[model samples]
Target: MNDTTATLDAPTADDALTRPFPGASPYDTYVHASLLNSLQQPLTEAPDEMGFLVTTQVMELWFTLIVHEWRTARVAFAKDDLDAALDALTRSRRALTALSGAWAPIAALTPARFNGFRAAFGRASGFQSAMYRHMEFLLGDKNAALLHGHSGDRAVHEALGETYREPSLYDEVLAFLHRQGRPVPAHVLDRDVTLPYRADPGVVETWRQIYTGPQHHPHLTLGELLTDIAELVTRWRSEHVMVVRRAMGAKPGSAGSSGLAWLQRRAARPVFPELWEVRGAC
Candidate 1:
């Protein structure tokens, strides 16, 4: 090759990717990695505490992304934008998978090792995570008591209150289907959005029709996407149970929850219940 060609092909010191920024790196500025690194202040010198703190913080970040995607999907459904809705749901499923995998760091901590750092944090439980609560609310698991718990934090209460009052992602999906001529029950359509959603027989029948109809139906694709998200969510909960079982076992949760039992109950509750119910008929 010619020298000119060789020079052009070779990476230069002045290349934008290799050049240093005038202040903080562009990536650091955009992502705020410095700010994030500063947040993990483990309270004890216990070796496991840092890992536990980092893992929990990482999970919180994944929760934020999942909530953002769910909200996007909800809006897309409201606008009758199936493709956009599916894209967002697909993103969230991947996030949930990663969220589940995040348990790896502390998954094997024995009870003794866990207790070494557990007492240091004192009542700061994963159950108190507002972001995770937002995910639950988005999935139609509205609990008045949970929302009320955040009442002392005006900003958090107001934000969660908006999600509580608005139709959940599932609610929007059913409305979108109704707009497409599906027979979603009028009672379900008109139900108070603030209340916890109950699985309606009519909704199950609607899903059954979709499952039994054309295999390539767009609505069927939507159903599968939702099912994937639901299963991943359940898997994440089950992994949480596993981690807690290994780390602390049957003990009370950091924030006074029933610990393993509470997590098991949550894992047992199916997401998008009608979709799961339709499987039997199909």
Candidate 2:
């Protein structure tokens, strides 16, 4: 190549070597990596604390992404936009997997290691995570009681209340299905959106039809996408239980819910209930 060709190629070749931005690079401007890097202020000198704090924060970020994507999916389904809904669900599945993988750093912390730093950060726990609650609400696990817990913080409470009153991503899916000629019942479609979603046989039958149909069908693809999401979320809960067990045994959570036992029960509850129930019939 000649010098002109070489100069044109220089930009591509020197991508790794280039640091000559006029100010911050577009990436830094959009992603704010410098600010993110400065966030890990571990409260104690304990070696394990930083890892624990970062892991929790990483999981919270993943929760935020998943919630955002699920809301995207919900709105898409509301409009009968299957492609958009699937795209969002696909993004959310990746986020959930990342969220589950985040447990690795603190996965092996023994009770003594956890105790070394746990007390320093008083009155905080995963139980108090607003982002995680948003994820749960997106999955149709609407708990008015949990939403009420955020009342003291008006901004958090109002944000959470919006999700609480809005139809869940799953609810929108059923509505989309109904529009597509599926037999989602009148009561289910018209039910109070603020109420916690209950598993209905009608919803289960709708999934059964999709699952029993052509494996490559679009609706079936949606079913599988939802199943993948459900399984990943359940895996995260299971990991949380294991981590909490290893870190604190049966001790109450810092936010006060009988830690291991409470998480165990919460983990036992299934997500996308009809998707799983349909499997037995299919």
Clashing pairs in 1: none
Q: Which segments of model 1 are wrong by more than 4 Å? A: 1-20
> For model 1, how many clashes?
0
Q: What is the C-alpha lDDT profile of model 2 across 1-282, one tens digit per residue?
A: 899989886667557666688888788899999888899998888999999888988887888888899999999998889999999999988888888899999999999999999998898877888988988887888899999988999999999999988999988999999999999999999999888788899899988988888889999999888889889989889998998888889998887778889999999888888898998998
lDDT (tens digit, per residue) of candidate 1 on 35-123: 99999898888999999999999999999999999999999999999999999999998998899899999999999899889999888
Clashes of each: 0, 0
Worst 10 residues of 2 by lDDT: 10-19
Task: Report model 1's TM-score to 2 decimal places.
Answer: 0.94
Instruction: Kindly report which residue pairs in candidate 2 clash with one another.
Output: none
